[model samples]
Target chain A: MSLLKEFKVLAFLVVLVTGAVLVYAIGDFPDWGDPISPASEHVSSYYIENAIHDTAVPNIVTALLADYRGFDTMFETVVVFVAGIAVLFMLRRPKRESEVSMDVSGSPIVKTATRIMVPMMQLFALYIVAHGHHSPGGGFQGGVILGASLILMAIAFGLPSALKKISNKATVMLSALGVLIFSGIGILCMFLGGNFLDYSVLSAILPGTDRVMARSHAMLGVEIGVALTVMTAMFSIYADLASEGQLDQGL
Target chain B: MIWQFDIIILTLVIVSALSALRIRDLLGSAIIFGVYSFLMCLLWAGMGAVDVAFTEATVGAGISTVLILATVLHTKRRTKD
Candidate 1:
C-alpha cells in the first residue's frame, strides 16, 4: 500500500479507538436528566435564582452573560475586535490585474432576492440584539446574523457594492467604538463608587432608576456594544478572506 | 433532552459530518459542513440551549458556509488526491 493509504488506515483506526473510549467514558458523567448533576447543583442554581432580581432581565442567560460575567464577555469582545484588526493587517494587499475574478453576483434572481430580504434580515438582527434581555438571542448571535446579511449582500451584489455601504474605514471605527462602549461602561461604574462593571452604581447617573433597573439598562448597552463589535469584525474577516486582501472582484 | 428529537438530529449530524470529511469537491464539502451545523443546531435546541443553537445556526451554518464557499471560489474546487 502507498504511504497515503497506510496513513489513512492508521488514522481511521485511531479515530475508531478514540470514539470507543469516549463512549465508554460517558458512563462517568452525570445522568442526562438528573437535577442533581454537579453543574446544576452549584453556581447555576444561584444564577437562576437571582438572575431576574439582580439584573432585572427576564432571560437568565443574558443576565449571567452580561451581568454576573460581564468582565469575561468584555475581554471576549476585545478578542473579537483584535481578530478583525489582525485579519485586516495581514490580508490587505493591492489588487492585481491577474487576480480579478469572473465577477461576483451569482444571478439576477439571487441578487433580487438579496435586495428584498437583506433589509428584513438586518431588521431581525437588530431586534435580536435589542431584545436579548427577554429572548434567546444575544450580542454574538445577533451580530453574526447582521454580519451574515452584509456577507450575503457581498456575495449577491459584489464586495464593492457592500463596501460602499460599510467601507473599510467605517468597519474599523465601528469595531473600536464597540470595544469603547463596553469598557466605558465599566469605567463609569468604577467612577460611581462600585467595582468594575458593577452596573448597580449606574443608577446614580440616571435619575429615578433603581439599581436593578440600572443594571438592566447597562446590560442592554453592553450587549449592543458586543453586537457592534462582532458584526463589524465578522464582516471585515469575510471581506479580507473573500477578496484575498485585494478587496475587489470577489465572489 | 428529548431522546426522540435528539436521536434523529444526532444521526443527521453524524452523517453530514462524515460526508463533509469524505467529499472530494471542496464546495460540496462546505455544503455538507453547513448541513452538519444545522443538525447540530437542532440538537442543541432540543437539549434546551436555544442561544447556543441560534449561534450554531447563524455562525456555524450561515457565516461559516459562506466563508467556505468564498474560499472555494478563490481556491481549487477539486481535490488533487
Candidate 2:
C-alpha cells in the first residue's frame, strides 16, 4: 500500500511538470487566424486561392480532402475497413445453440419515434454527403450519421432486426465495395491517360463537362465511396461490440 | 470567438473531463465523457471550424458515447481502481 501511494505521488508530480512544460511551449504558438503563420502561408494559401479554379468546389476542405490529398483519404477508408475486420476477428464468436436473445426494445413509443426519425436521419445524411462540396460535411460525417440511424433501429427494435437489413456478410462486402469504388475511380483516371486520382482528365469520358466540372463530379464519386465505407464500418463495430460479436440481440 | 463563451465552455470542458476521469461508475464516466466531447464540439464551432465541429459532434459525442455504453453493458458498472 505504501509503495502504491508513493507511485501515485510520483505520477502526479510528473503530470504537473509535463503540464507546465506544455503550457510554456504554447506561448510560442502563432496567434489565432495568423495569416503569416507557417501553416496558413504555404499550401493552405494555394488551396484557398485555387481550389475553386482547379476543382470547381466551393469548400476548400472538401477539395483538399477528396481531390488534393485523395490518396490519403482512400487509405483512411481502408484503415476503417481493416479496423472492422480486426474487431470481428478479435470478438466475433460462432453462433451457439444455447445462445439467448436479449430484449433491448424500449417501448412502443420509442419504436414509433425511431421509425419517424430514421427516415429523416437517412435523408439528412444523404444531403450531407451530396452537399459536402459546398458545405461543411462530407463522407466521414455523413457515413457516421447513416450508421447511427441503423444503430437507432437496433436500439429501438433489436439487433436482429437491424442485422436483417445489413447482415454480417453484407457489412464486409459493403465496406470492401467502398474502397473498390474509390480506387476504381482512380484506376479509371489512369486508363484515361491521367495520373491516379487526377479528376481533371476524367472530362474526356464524362460528356458535356470540362476539366473543372469533371474534377467536381469525380470528387462526389469519391465522397460516396468514403461514406459507404465509413457508415458500414461504424455499424459493424457497434454491432460487434454490442453483441460481443454474436450477431444476436444487443442492448 | 467571444471571450466569455470561450471561457465558460472551456471551463465546463475541463470540469467534465476531470469528472469523467474521477468518477467511479463506468456508466457515469462514459456519459460525462460524452458531455466533454460535446463541449469540445461547441468550442470548435465557435472557433469557426464548422466541419471539424460536425465531425466531433457525430463521432466524438454521438457514436462514441453509444459505443461506450454498449461496451459497458458487458462489463461491471463500477470501476475497481
Off by over 4 Å in 2: none
lDDT of 2 by residue, A1-251 (tens): 99999999999999999999999999999999999988898799899889999989999989999999999999999998899889989989888677566677879999999999999999999999999999999999999999999999999899999989888799889999999999999999999999999999999989999999999999999999999999999999999999888888879
Candidate 2 local distance difference test against the native? 0.94
Which 10 residues in a row give candidate 1 chain A its minimum summed lDDT? A97-106
Among incorrect, acceptable, medium and high, the docking class of model 2 is high
- How large is the C-alpha RMSD of every model relative to the true structure? 1.8, 0.9
Highest-scoring model, TM-score = 2
Query: Which residue pairs overlap in candidate 2's backbone?
Result: none
User: Which digits, one per residue and each the tens of the lDDT, describe model 1 over residues A68-175?
Assistant: 999999999999999999989999997787754666677999999998999999999999999999999989998998998998899898888899999989999999
What is the alpha-carbon lDDT of model 1 when measured against the actual structure?
Answer: 0.91
